[model samples]
Target: MVEIKRPSPTDLLTIGEVVARTGVAASALHFYERKGLIHPERTAGGTRLYPRHVERRIAIIQVAKRLGIPLSEVAEQFGTLPSDRMPSLRDWNRLNERWRARLRARQLELERLQEEMTQCIGCGCVSLNACLVMNPGDQLGAEGHGARRLLPIEDEVPEGVGRDSH
Candidate 1:
């Protein structure tokens, strides 16, 4: 009879095993290691061995990436934890809160940009009469480049319409 040996709970996973389990490319894992985002032990034979807890960390990283969070920001959060231990539930909660706030801020910024686009579809066109009131002779051009004053709101509006009327 052929014998099949299964990995025990304490057994470290090889890079290939982690790749199979996490669906993260081997190159990405290596890049994460190089960037100090993840720390994997090496066997005497110079093979990478990851602890089972790494799967959770990888999941967190994937979630952050999906949320449009940069790897550097994710790394900064991970760096707060002890190098020898995986993040506890409390740690994950704190990180989640921080990321949630960042995402909310980004959402607001995107909403503001969308509102500006609706206000001035052709910012470069001179035929827009409203541009004189909204942009005031391309005053945004002085604030460097690419969509300035888009975040700020003016008090004055047409008739009884408020800023959010449109």
Candidate 2:
């Protein structure tokens, strides 16, 4: 039988190697490529060859995803970097700083929703007092549609329900 050759750890890694190393699906890597999140080089025969640093990038992408950052957003952030190199610690710090505010805001919004959900649990239907106070002639519907009251606006947070609400 002919000997099967494998890429050395110091050499460029193929997509399959990246999948094995990173535990990210091959399809996701392709999607990352398409979205411009990752930039892999092509061999003369057209096989994708990723620098070893891609493993770290893939890990970063996974962490960002778990933090509820969208792939588009990840792509946008990663787009600021040089394609062939690993992101530096400073780069990671900058990325985190940029995402910190957005993540905090999202956390606040979710907390607000949770509070609203808890408060509104008792009244399941149109009641005399709750209806007048909550729906208020369906004014929320005018804003668009779909449980508008459930998602309260920043200014609309009830007397005791926002930052001060909690």
Tens digits of per-residue lDDT for model 1, 35-129 = 78878999999999987778888898899889988899888998886656666788888988998899999999889877766667656544433
Model 2 lDDT tens row, 1-166? 9999874434688898899988999999999888888778898899999888777778888998899888888888888766767677898889889899898999998897776566676556454334434554665566664664455576666675556534
RMSD after Cα superposition, model 2: 13.8
Question: Which candidate leads in lDDT?
Answer: 1
Q: What C-alpha RMSD separates each model from the true structure?
A: 13.5, 13.8
Please list the residue runs of candidate 1 whose C-alpha ends up more than 4 Å from where it truly belongs after superposition. Answer: 1-11, 121-166
Which candidate should be chosen as best, given TM-score against the real structure?
1
List where candidate 2 sits over 4 angstroms from the true fold: 1-11, 122-166
Q: Rate the local accuracy (lDDT) of all candidates.
A: 0.79, 0.78
**What's the lDDT for candidate 2?**
0.78
